[model samples]
Target chain A: EFDQIHNYFSLNPLYRASEMRKDTAGLQAAKNNMSTKFVLFSDQKPFLLRSEEPSRKYKFAVFNINQLGTELLERGTVIFLGLETWDPDSNAWFAVDIKEELSDIGPKFFPEGKYATPFPVTMQMEPTQAGIFAEAHSVLCWLDKYKFCSTCGSATKIAEGGYKRVCQNWECSSNKGVQNTCYPRVDPSLIMLVVSPDKKDCLLGRQKRFPPKMYSCLAGFMEPGECLEDTCRREVEEESGIKVGRVDYHSSQPWPFPAVLMLGCIAYARTSALKVDTSELEEARWFSRAEVAQMLAGQHPHGLYVPPGEAIAHQLIKSWVASSFSNL
Target chain B: EFDQIHNYFSLNPLYRASEMRKDTAGLQAAKNNMSTKFVLFSDQKPFLLRSEEPSRKYKFAVFNINQLGTELLERGTVIFLGLETWDPDSNAWFAVDIKEELSDIGPKFFPEGKYATPFPVTMQMEPTQAGIFAEAHSVLCWLDKYKFCSTCGSATKIAEGGYKRVCQNWECSSNKGVQNTCYPRVDPSLIMLVVSPDKKDCLLGRQKRFPPKMYSCLAGFMEPGECLEDTCRREVEEESGIKVGRVDYHSSQPWPFPAVLMLGCIAYARTSALKVDTSELEEARWFSRAEVAQMLAGQHPHGLYVPPGEAIAHQLIKSWVASSFSNL
Candidate 1:
């Protein structure tokens, strides 16, 4: 049986009525519906509500249409997230990116709400809510960065309920056929756990930007004309000088840190030599199974640790420790 | 044992010396080396040399450094492909896109060479040469479209051996940490063969643009915050009104029809009913295993056919037919 891993940003709850995107009137009706909810963002930060309990956790702060005034609604880019439920009368969910100048409006709407970055907030929230936050933040970031059309340096307008951007220049090549250039760009990246030849050890690397003593799976973006397997072998060889033999798919995660799909895999190394690329990594070394277990349990002698459970890297390491490497 | 399918455009022969990309002097020396060869493109079409045999097959028309004048080299965007072999003294390979006005120069360099669209040429070339053409075309297409920075509207300068385009504006956020926006964009798409609940039949769909009677698997560009599984389920439901229950990874292919990595899968359908979305698909229906086999053999009663062997769809269908559904 293939046991799929549902990572932090993977458990989305919305129905994503994709066919309804072209129905502008239906979207507008949903936006004006009394039961509709809106997730607000300011400067790409989500407006989250703090729990009153001792844990002080955060949850998505959603507002009704009335809570957002006409001025705010008009100024912000509202994306139709989808229906909250599959029922025809179910509430619709939308995400709007409020301007930085209107950052105080979030507090006005929800007195206990504050805008915060996705990192700690996503880790703290429920998986379903985190998934929603991921979708909203990724779409908003794409919208912010893609103001001008890549084909023609012309201002583009939001279309298809924020799912697409259309260049105003009618004669632009992007406006011709598939309009693929107008869609939100999602960069596919490979993140893998590299097992040694003996299968007793796994390779991990830490970048200069990583937290002290923290190391995780080696990863890089998927380049053109390369499959997931090619990416795995190439990235492993480039980063740690390890030659990979067999690559198996584990699971995938939608990393909304500016729209990336993390394709996770287990790559068996043909060679164990570690020649770390200093430009890409601070250090790369082989970690034995026992040491990995200790790191996961936060009992490592060197104060070493992996990423949190929310990251696919942690799941990859955990799976490696649990499996015999042959099955995976 | 897991058998890998090496589809056309997947078998790249070059040794991509990624580490040396940053060494400008070294790249220059490799470019000017006597053994270095260059692939030429005009208006996004590859220059091909037709074979003298009856097959009239085409191969990549490569040019040495001397054949390309300084004026033409300066006018075109030169991309270092990689070394022809892993040996230190091996020849280097590069790709350059010539201006439309300079199309006549290709014939001058090689009288037998002709610039043609990648479709027929790619289908007719050797698999290794086709892979090179896929890479060169994808990269050149990216360079052509991404003249302006997505983050900032400023005209960008080529960097990192055509792998990156840096915004000239120092204030642009893309210039800071990581410089992710500067990298070439490769969109991840899902192409899946949907099997029926009983596993006796499979679903196929045809877009209006597809050749008459040619049915292929359902595909869609993955949206933000969606795992491969989620994309499979959503795209299947949206395109054919079939709810996918379990999605299994088959393999992947790099389709350079403007830079897409096709993630191929076999999805088990929970619902067998079909309600085709006309806007997306011209028609969709379930074909029994016998019918699929006939179609693959080009013996379908209605002259129906599947995609060619070079496509991942063909591989997915072939695997399904060869293995018991449980094993796949």
Candidate 2:
């Protein structure tokens, strides 16, 4: 099942030439290239070029140098995402910006409501576009909120080609070793598809924020003193009364609902009991393997639907079901 | 070899009992118990009950509630770091504080210089003590720095039994779902022992900050939008120009020199070449299995030494050597 869940967000068609980011000459050259592409966001919504026909799939309204000629660029922060390897050999650098400059200029260029789209809608586009959107959205979101230093009240300056922020106060501890204040942040979270001892059923839970009849895997942030395995076990036992034995890493997805790295896993449970923690989850129950397969296929008798392809939860459930069915 | 590398820091001899954290009454009752222990810190250094004789090992200078007398307790913060099950079923809630309230009073109660020891020195103590120290140190370090909210720059308030911080601003986004701003921080890092295709030699690197001839496994922070396996491969290649194939998780250690989860792994490299990134590492080279074994045994012929048993890198090398030797 390697790369079975391909085309998810963050699986971009770009080579993040991170090693070359520090080279000012190389970055400058790539940025000024004619093939260089720019994507704009307004209030977290991406300015995408959509097809006129409703039946056609969505596409990103990616802008080139002529489309966003150097005007009012200072009003917004620009992040150098990476060089697009769409052809796997091209040297075109792609950057993204979330600024009022684009919001004002976008309406004059593309039709209103047709150009700007939220992140969730972008999932309908090609995988490369969605991945680019995730990279831009997450970095822009972090910049918007983290304008001030957490250690001190001093404002920070963007460095390392928008990949890092440094506090202006030279005396602050953030200025010292490793520069903790700098770097883009990613909250690591564990999401597991817990299987029963008999392997015929799996545990699923739903939070209050989840849609009606939609259940997903148990998840929580990886805490300070715990490993990935222990985090999965603890979160499972906390949300539901299942005692997990062995945990196997499945896949990973970059969830940009404010920057999260979703580590998906397949957990083996020793106990099949249910003692739901209502505070953490609204409902938790064991679904038979057959029923889970139905849910994944969107033919559940009860109309219980799982999340779409954009979510790691969907992939986790789908992968497990496919493997189990093949064994049968 | 499941718990072969046991008795390391952050490997506690007790359950965290996190489900009971919100139970204020239970916590209050546990705090006043005679068996409940208090480990105090001064400036991030833990206070231990050192032996008068040089031959005896160090111990944590834990004080009970009856010993503190409840006077001047308000000057510092206290965090409950689970229970110690060393005495079988005896319940003892262990708490730690890093306040100066003990700096003046600690010497009066215990032997001079014996009660206040730095963090690295505490590694000489029992695993349970070291684990407790890690918990307290990580939580206190976070609280010490995160006094103000990064989102709004407003002062925050402690909530959820010192596990979370809430912004005072009502309209702040921290007040919304999930409360991202209010959690203990843990930076995830990957540390891997890369082995050659022939399995006879392994790669090691040394930073400028490291002691002379002390080469450990390569490590780097797990960046956002990347998985643990990818982090290992990327970091290894970036630091030493070694292209890795399969990456296997070995173990994890909570390195709380300000809260970092060091995930140890065993990497299988496709190529055994070294093109060291001089900026990231001072030196990197391939060491034969015989040399690594000598370093682990603290009897290297060239006077080179690996980190002691305290570091995950040492354990990783030791585990690989043992496994490889068995194959012979």
Candidate 3:
């Protein structure tokens, strides 16, 4: 998955160039700022309902960006997965401040409210700094949520640069000095574009949260003991009612919006049939490669478009339309 | 890192010439009766302490290699992380496992009297069967260690393929999820051999772990709010008590044997005088290019050699000694 790019993790120090040198310096400047840094996170609160016998806890985080948070551009800004959604009825939700160059981001994304945190956060990052920060963000987010030991159900404590958590329940004894049961994890997922035999049309699906008329490649969280290709095929079939036969390899992207490694693949559809599950998705349909190119180029006669480049699904669809491969 | 040698990850879909032919027959043929199928992993788990102490209480899944586990060698064995040690005493510990050839796993890895429960986890895997499993192992180990939510002192619960953990304490209301902290969290570190204008030799130090008289490049862990060059300079000064400047990056590698990305760099020494901290390291010295060449060629009269190929330290030392700029 990290094959093509010189990820901060895989990059060899001896092979750096002039541009990368500047980028590294640029990133350090941001980290050393020591000033207020904007941290976008999910805040899920459980409240008791009078009508219900037991309290029903709603799992959510705020995806809303307000003037106070967005105004931190000059100070700093970072975005990641959160639980709260912007209540359209209220005008509280604001747009993310991605500095100046990414102005198009506000228009294409979050015109109403961003469904999730956008990728490639800013505030002076080196080329690979964002990726590293995202990696850290996912794990940090994970640690923030799981504070108690699951095995014995004891309150946990943090250690080692906020990297570890230990149980406080002395009687439980499930946790030691630096180890506990609740796990830190990365979700390995497969997001694929199902291709037609003639290589003319591609598969895309729309969900209720998607902006009106917006479509994207099929995707699903990988199940345990299942293969990537199988997951791809299964998700395609389940969402669009398509039976994938031969699955081709494409690319991968780390969507740390909530700790997911998006494994992108291309599958061959046995029969082009449309069966959309409204419960899961609003519609599933096949679009021609030309139509996708037009959408990507923003020249679609129907005024349709795909997701932006920050996502692997958008890249997957773009790859098919261009017959090009992305090294991510 | 990947710039020098792009491997399976870079090759994309054409994995080792295995194409996705449109036939289930290929799938069946790919399946093996004995060792044809096996669990694969990417994260290197050094099981230094198996069935011991705080970790001992935790359930570790191991196969007997009888009819169920190793007995299915035609299907192969599920290799995983478990601590192995030469001394049973608490003073020392090490993470151990078999990462060498599958044909060579020994009694050292599967010691006697360590019986584990077999859950009979059955499932069909696909395209790189070992990929996700490795992710699971790494993440699970991390969870076993990270008990508390680092941000807020609360308990956490596992979620999303063991990929995430959520804080249960309603008062704290922290929702962070997956983390990379574990028994072997990969510490992204940078190391360098500081050179001089005279170019007579570069700095190398002997750690407590190194054999007597052995010397290698000075290295240090990368700190937060620092760049690679900053790390190079800080590490050089911290270890040898020498001032280093003019840092240049060279290469990188995945030292996954407990999760460490080693960044190799070359630097200019501002001072020639050496002052060693004997507590952390045995000795600090500069070896001429001639001496290092003999060490690299394994003909050093003193029988001193650099680290192995799996480490970037050896590469850094060798590259500096063998480079045309050695005299500069």
> What C-alpha lDDT values do all the predictions have?
0.87, 0.74, 0.48
Each candidate's interface RMSD:
2.3, 3.2, 10.7
The CAPRI classification for model 2 reads as acceptable
Worst lDDT window (10 residues) for model 1 chain A?
Answer: A50-59
Error of 2 at B276 (Å): 1.1
lDDT of 3 by residue, B196-247 (tens): 6577887778888776766778776653323455456656765777877576
Per-model TM-score versus the true fold = 0.96, 0.88, 0.41
Clashes of each: 0, 3, 61
What is the two-chain DockQ of model 1? 0.62
Stretches of candidate 2 above 4 Å error? A1-7, A19-30, A51-57, A85-94, A100-102, A107-119, A322-328, B1-7, B19-30, B51-57, B83-94, B112-119, B197-200, B323-328
Q: Best TM-score goes to which candidate?
A: 1
Q: How high is the TM-score of chain A in model 2?
A: 0.90
lDDT of 2 by residue, B1-328 (tens): 1222342665665556676567777776777788777777676667677655463356667678876656634465666676664232357555555466457655557765454445567667666667766777787777777777777778887665567788889898878876456788777788999998788888988999898989899999876556677678778988888888888877778887777888788999889878999998999998888888888888998889898888888899888888834333
Residue by residue across B222-307, what tens digits does model 1's lDDT show? Answer: 99999999999989998898988889998999999889999999999988979899998999999888899999999999999999
Candidate 3 residue-wise lDDT, A60-143, digit = tens: 122323323334433322322111222211111111223344333333423442223333222123324344344445555555
| Reference-based lDDT, residue A308, model 1 | 85
- Chain A TM-score per candidate? 0.96, 0.90, 0.61
Question: Candidate 2 on A105-161: residue-level lDDT in tens?
Answer: 665566643545555676676766777777777777777777777777578887666
